[model samples]
Target: MKNSKRWGRRVLSALAAAAVLAAVPVGAAGNGKSKGKPPASSHRYIEVQLLGINDFHGQLNVTRKVGGREVGRADYLAAYLKQREAENKNTLLVHAGDAVGASPPVSALLQDEPTIEVLNKLGFDVGTLGNHEFDEGVAEMLRLIHGGYHPATGDFAGADFPYVSANVVDAQTGKPILPPYVIKRVNGMPIGLIGVTLTETPTIVTPSGVAGVKFIDEATAINKAVRELKKKGVQTIVVLAHNPGVSNPDGTNASGEIVDIAKNVDDEVDVIFAGHNHAYLNAVVDGKLLVQSYSYGTAFSDVDLKIDPRTKDVVAKKAEIVTTYHDGITPDPEIRALVEKYEAKVAPLVNQVVGTAAETITDEQNESGESALGNLIADAQRAAMKTDFAFMNPGGIRADIEQGEVTWGELYNVQPFNNQLVKMTLTGAQIRQLLNQQWQPTQTRMLQISGLRYTWSASRPVGEKVIDIQLPDGTPLKPDAEYTVTVNSFLADGGDGFTVLTHGTNREVGPVDLDALVTYIRQLSQPFSAQIEGRITKLQ
Candidate 1:
């Protein structure tokens, strides 16, 4: 993109130096040069508004409760965003990432085309990729972004907004798959936006999702983009980083991957928008403004920058994390209509009653890392495959089973990845090894199991955490004995770092996870309830 007009050449005066001292975070002001001089009067200070959202997992018709207030839904989010955009003539809408994957039936059922369509209607200016965007792998991601034919969705026009990522690159060519940055002019002042996702994407996403791509260091890529942008005479810069960050409501004690990136990047970079943790953050760290709104359509980040026209540098910046409370505004009619269209199309399958829940079965784990919903899902997969045992990854369980009248859509929401269940043979020793893999150095990912029980001690080392494994018949697991095991395609392929699964033999793929869940629920007694059953034990 080209700048609308060239900025007048000027050196920073004492006033500009003062603004830099006041506006820029401590130690963040560059080496006393290239700082922009502020306009003489307050009226000359150009107010540019940047509205950003992140981790919107395509809840087109879903509403969520935030702080006891009902907030969210595509149409309501659109109304709030549009209202905020109208408050300033110089405004841009952007997203950090995860706009599509792990979505509800309304969008995921249609290949997430409706999510992109709604973002198009809202006129998003730029975006970056989150780990979820890579859930289906690179080719499909590009198909969603650049418009291509899919057997499910047919011909499609992709996102109108540009997707920029400074770090993600093709493995073979070692070149960025998308542009590193995009420059957009607001009121004739150029603002450069650089995008990058977390380098840990590979660990969280299914292995196939990140195949043939590599995510380099976020800060290194960002600094490179800053140098390139500066060569293009762009003084103002913002980063859309799909990395996690969090701070208190008062903007104190900032921490996370994004904070590190902001500190390491060039001082000329002004604002950083963060995502992936799905938390609230609006803090000034290392002389840069960092902000992230909570995930879904629940909230958004409103960042305003005061730019000096002559110098085209950000002179002042502030941000507000706004919740999309439905109380104050009417939903946008156009987006509402679009959402209804998709919802109606999916209603036939989504609304079908599969079973009833006596009470909510939540993904909330106990001290031993076992959850009711996780147990339910693992049992379902095991039943579908007729396996001796089954393991379910906690991340695969997305939502709670609300009390009464469970629907196909609800089960779909709970297991949206549609991974086919795989029955494989693993020796008892291998099962113990797989259970121990949960305590990796970076994080713990406890697997939910069915037809077996195990105890783990936090005091044990990473690879030796499992104290004992036993079958339901009270027989101690024997190392030499091979047993049938079931897991989703993601786990079978070693997703979430369960590499031991890759060693399994005699693998047979069965029904998709959602279908297995639906079938299991349908056959259950009415008003079924699942609970923690002492499958995992913690050492005191």
Candidate 2:
């Protein structure tokens, strides 16, 4: 429901660690005690501190709640990283992808250049590309990486750290656009880091943008890369992966795809850092370390790995996922200054007033079958297209709109990705199949519909579970008739398992998704209310 999933155990363990550490006296250290001189052994222990964050979406400035509490800004995140680096010499800061696009106005206005600038300044060692990174098209993505200038400052600066995607390849040439992996020498050890984005990139990203690119099997790519790295004599192998791992509600590892990848991957890989589902995870899977920090910089993960100098393999490791709270920590001066400068440059555009909301619209009710805000957004898209119905994935909605005067900034916050709307015609049978698929037990089949109503029994087998279906006008859906439906490009290209929508006829592009919503809201001066009633009913 929150458009992100994390392992519940990770969050609970983090909180538990925090609680236990808080109770101890300040000077008390855990079992990590070491003598002044090196111990007499053939192998040596080199402490490697890996700090990881993912799915930033280019938020540059701190956000204040209605009550003035601050959360996740680039500057605040930099401070957190700087503190950790100061404590360890063998430190590497990495991102697991989706760092650009879906950005706030400050970074969005500059086409996500500001966010990259901040990342470079913050000393990010490497990053994997997320599906959204291709939203601007592959050419634009390359331009941004090579010589793109920041929209806010007009300064031309390239990527400070290499961005890798071993799985994404050119369809015609079969060559990777960027290098698949890079070897970094950290404190006299040659560490091979392989970065891989999700194979679902084509389905989730705009088709035209990724027209000539093919995302290969992730496991295949990683295996191939690891073999090469090992041949090159690289001892320690770290994988920065942009794929989703199974997680429970409170942030613990759940048995899913990631577990299989960890257990079956080539033994050359020692650690796996993951993202895409935006869930927090810090668990050992099949004897390999797996971690995914929560999205939007809400938390950062610190993995302390002790590697044997002779074998270059991990001997002992500990991981802690820490939340970024402004209460006790002070912002790093350099990062704070950078954020302040960017905020000033984009102030006017970000502060503009947009519209009003009659009630609070939130993404918090993600676990439930229906969401008031998600329904309102789907309805708006349907109305804009003037079609038989509309459907929106809950993952597309990013932020919550409070009950009060809303600004264009607030609207952008809700649907920040700037995704376009596409209308297509589908047969009634195809629609039923699409509706039925939403009940899949795998959790990836859920759909957010706009102009339709249906009752379903999740307890039944997925495809046979739809009990009733009707059009927005309350007409019983005719299985043979063709109907025009409105949906975002993400789903039309088969994102979130809506392959049925891709089998439609007379497809046409409409307005951008967020633009359509903005237009609908601008036309209404009075506050509008929305509710999730029978749009999707769960029956026993």
Candidate 3:
């Protein structure tokens, strides 16, 4: 009562702060001006900034203790967008797919609903479908699309953005699973976004979930959709392709799938944002701008397109790949709070101690050629299947273990996805052919081996590359004898261009991948060390 005037001023300050916090920086009209008017150039040139991210895999925070730090998470991403809009009034945010599912415990607890809500809060304009989106099944995906709330949480917050998939069609009705394309007017420019997932979706996804669905040829579906959009007077077109990209071992863009797609793509499509292989790319293929950001939201791609006013055609295009570092940027408080809340709720399961590691296990060296981690995993699979040989893809190993101790969380980090281990028998000749294909220049053919030792000449051509092969007991393998081999379902079905593996005879062994690895680790109560000694030797 004695200091009523001071109390009034404090209340006023608090109200002012609240007002400032209420407005998210997304799509704010600059200079307090109306948004409907054309720029001073009278539409002479429309500067549209296309912001894209792909293969997020539900990582809601920065990865720590890797070679380098990676900054991501929905709120930090939102801050980045707001910063961009301040520079360019005409901006559109898009995703190239793999936005939901295959996430950590926090997201997995709610079936990735929290991630979707955060994406909506960040104002994603459009998104294509990724293979992981089908992890739960197509029906659930459709439910997620048409105003369905999370099964765990009874909230009514639906997808504020649109999901597009032109190639995925119902086998019986021959109709798209989702709308083939979405046309949006951004900054007064009518733009068309077409979505196309990989045709290999049939093999990668569960057969039952996609039982009545057929994924058409990507190039064919994209061309047809672009033509339809063009007929509707949409001159600028962007294709969100979930197919893999071509990249060199150095992480630089190479001329392969992207080039092939560009050559066959419709002329009307001005830009192509690609994903699925988790490659980083920014280049011009056949006069069209092509860009792919690295996976896990470690990077963001900003593409600027200058459109001609009269013709509505793109006159110029430029792309910039920006690495998201958590250091310089402050995490948006709201998003940080949400992440903390979810983390606390899921802490018991996510942070539960599992086991300990006697030595370091890493994926860094595993992808290059042969690796200790890969060898250990392959050995584990071989032991579980009791097979003649075993192979595990380097990309399948997600994380590393420290030397001092290991935990269940660490193992999950290594094999996060719940892929199944499948055993099959193949003729010796067929196995030889499969080994030969591993030497393909464009393929990441590094194989983790069990009960084998071999040397190869990198300079030699395909079939002649495998210089030697041996059984665990130091016996030469007979070309006529059949061998039982074990591999994850992904490779057994021709993932990573291993088409030869498809010729194997299905043995029908049922062992879940991550569970098998966990069991293998538990059996070895003592700390175990993996040596990369002679698993693979490159010829000089």
Residue 53's lDDT in candidate 1: 94
TM-score of model 2 vs. true structure = 0.86
CA RMSD (A), model 3: 11.5
- How would you encode candidate 1's per-residue C-alpha lDDT over 1-540 as one tens digit per residue? 000000100111221222223333211212211123334664587889999998898988887664445667999889888877776879999999989888999999898999999999999999999888887889988988999999988998999999999899999998999999999999999999999988988866777778899999999999999999999999999999999887776688888889988889999999999988777778999889999877787777878899998999998898777666677568899999999999999999999999999999987889999989889999999999999999998877777899989999988888888888899999998999999998877568888999999888888877998998889998999999999999988888777778999999999999999999999988988989899999998977
Q: Pick by lDDT: which candidate is best?
A: 1
Give residue 46's error in model 2 in angstroms: 2.3
lDDT (tens digit, per residue) of candidate 2 on 1-540 = 012222231232343234224212111212121112223556468888898987787877745321133446777677777877877889999988888777787777777787888889988899888877786788768767776654544655667889887888989999888888999888888888888877756655656767778888888888889998989998688888888774442334455566677777787687888877766566777677887766676656777788888877778876665556555566678877877787787778777766778888765444336778778788789888999878887667777778988877778878876667889999889989888766544564446677788877767775888878987678889999988899887778776667888887798898888888878877775686666666778785
Clashes of 1: 1
Question: Which pairs clash inside model 3?
Answer: 354-408, 355-406, 356-406, 357-406
Model 2 scores what on Cα lDDT?
Answer: 0.73
C-alpha RMSD of candidate 1: 9.4
RMSD in Å for all candidates = 9.4, 4.7, 11.5
Task: Report the lDDT of model 3 for residue 508.
Answer: 68
What lDDT tens digits, residue by residue, belong to model 3 across residues 1-540? 000000111122222222223222211211122123333654468788898988776777535321234346756666666666567768888898878665666666666776777777677899998887776778767666665655576654567899989999999898998999999886677899999987766655555546678898888888889889989999999999887664332334555566688879888889989877665567777777787766666556778888887888889887665555455566667777777787787777667655667778764453236777888788889888888889887656766677866666567667766778889998777776777776655454576778777777767878778777777677877789988999887677676567888788866655878778878877876777777767677878
Best candidate, TM-score-wise?
1
lDDT score of residue 365 within candidate 1: 84
